[model samples]
Target: MDFSVRTVRADEWERARDIRLAALQDPAAPIAFLETYEGASAQPDSFWRERTEGGSESGGGRVRQFVAETSDGRWVGTVSVLVERPSDEVRFGAPAKVDQTHLVGVFVRPEARGTGVIDALFRAAVDWSWTLPEPAIQRVRLYVHEDNARAAAFYRRFGFVATGETVAMPGDESAFEIEYELPRPEAGA
Candidate 1:
């Protein structure tokens, strides 16, 4: 499967929404995503259109969403990176890990899993983080539920390391979300 991984186009919001809804329907959806498929699927088409457009370059960079599309133009997976500033707002902690990108909403269709689409999507997201100019990100990070061992293994294989950080999962005392980080590059990546 020769797939092209690139920043999503504003016009493809429906495609993006479709893949997300599919991901949320997977068995591991509870551990893999923050939202339920039911919620996202119920959203109006206009909402998805606006959401996808917001992640495009024209939207001033609040979020950067990448998608993996087959050679024939079918979108199969997606990931979103949210930029964070170090001086004030911190994610999950007080110090605010300065100048970083938060990886979220990662979803690769089950049929596409293990077919290298994941690496392509991740490369797209990681590469995008390294290109930011202002506040120059120092790292890219994500949180995964401890019980989601499958995802944790993949993150480690992709060069992300556990950062000794853990956050209590809301409503789940027995399980915690662990943080993983990939050091940022000093120059254009």
Candidate 2:
């Protein structure tokens, strides 16, 4: 509750990389993220810089990353949204059937959990998605590992309903990830 949520800046790549590395080490990382801590940490500084730059405010309208920073300037949470157009190639499970934004790389420090940081981060991400100009985004979606009950619960509480779509988790065809989405709200409602 003491933190403020806002889009990330290109210059803050180092901070972004640090928080992400922390997230990848969380116990839930296996189910919550497609990449492993080892894989991410092994990435060079250049990779982190490019990745952060691509999602920063100056990173063209294709993607945006929001972070929750405390009054002291520590970033405790983050959520990135990737704008997907019907004509664009798919990045994960499926191709975009409509103008939509895929929410990814969601994370909140363990100490920051249950303190409203996640909610604030999500609100910022979703609000930004809805505000995109031209071929407006029609929906916001995310995939959760089938066994990630905690994440699914939060997504449901946040108004994202399960779309009943499932795809094999990458690198592990035996496991599945379910899709959940929040359709654009009606005007004034």
Candidate 3:
């Protein structure tokens, strides 16, 4: 593909908001994301501004969002990662026993699916995770809805193995999300 993948800019919140709304409208959003179109659409512009900036390259570095933009300047896909720490007051899934990155908000425009965009976006996200300073991120993880076979298969192909942990989906407790992780490659191995 001719698209370029990079961390989002703090100043591009509008674009970020636009792409996210598009993602929430995808047919699989119910299984793929925790937020709904109605909920997201109701958020004020300030909410999106903070949300985008929090994950931008110039943001605090605890989170990052990557986007694939075509040569014509259209964003075709996106993926976001949040740093999780053992001492954090809140937890997304199981408390992090070690520093880790939680991958979320993965999506691609239908027309852009299966064209290598997802692979490139993941490379950016995971590679960024490996470069964290200090103790260094021990692993990168993501949760897939139990019934989302397509996402699970792709995650496996990308080297994420189930850790045998499952968390009830936020809104639908009847459904669950399975956790997957890719431990950092050992140095000099």
Candidate 4:
């Protein structure tokens, strides 16, 4: 794909914010993202700073953000993974049963959608989950809106089997989030 997948730097908060806002403006944003572009764009610079740092290595927040940079040095895609410890509160429901990496905030620029950037970004996120040291991740998971068939298909193709887990959408009736997981590699196999 000729794209460079790498962790985002904490200092690149501005760039991060730009891409995220752009993603929110995409046609599928209503079902693909929880936050609106208007909301994100209105957030203070401090918000972006904290969010960027929280997902960067230097922040030590147990979360990582990976960006797919094109040959021209533009960030065309991004995916963030948040490590969830067993004791931590479940992101939107029950506490995690085992240590895991919860993938979120995935987005690819409209122009880069079909150029293999999504696969590359996903690989980077999944690989990072297994590479963590403290608490050692056991699995990687992501949630997709029930109606996002296009994304659901891609998740299936990427080896994230549906765990049959479902979470009701917050403050919304007749909507649910379907969970999919990527199993970790076994030791000494």
Number of the predicted model whose lDDT against the real structure is largest: 3
TM, every model: 0.91, 0.98, 0.97, 0.95
Candidate 2 matches the true fold with a TM-score of: 0.98
Residue pairs in candidate 2 whose N, alpha carbon or C atoms collide under 3 angstroms:
none
Clashes of 4: 0
The residue pairs found clashing in candidate 1 are none
Task: Write the residue-wise lDDT of candidate 3 on 72-178 in tens digits.
Answer: 99999999999998887555689999999999999999999999999999999999999999789999999999999999999999999999999998878899999
Off by over 4 Å in 3: none
- In angstroms, how far off is 36's CA in candidate 3? 0.4
Cand. 1 Cα-lDDT: 0.86
The global Cα lDDT (0 to 1) of model 2 is: 0.93
State candidate 1's TM-score.
Answer: 0.91
What Cα-based lDDT does every candidate model obtain? Answer: 0.86, 0.93, 0.94, 0.88
Please give the RMSD of candidate 2 to the true structure.
Answer: 0.8
Worst 10 contiguous positions by lDDT, candidate 2: 52-61
Better of 2 and 4 by lDDT: 2
lDDT of 2 at 73: 97
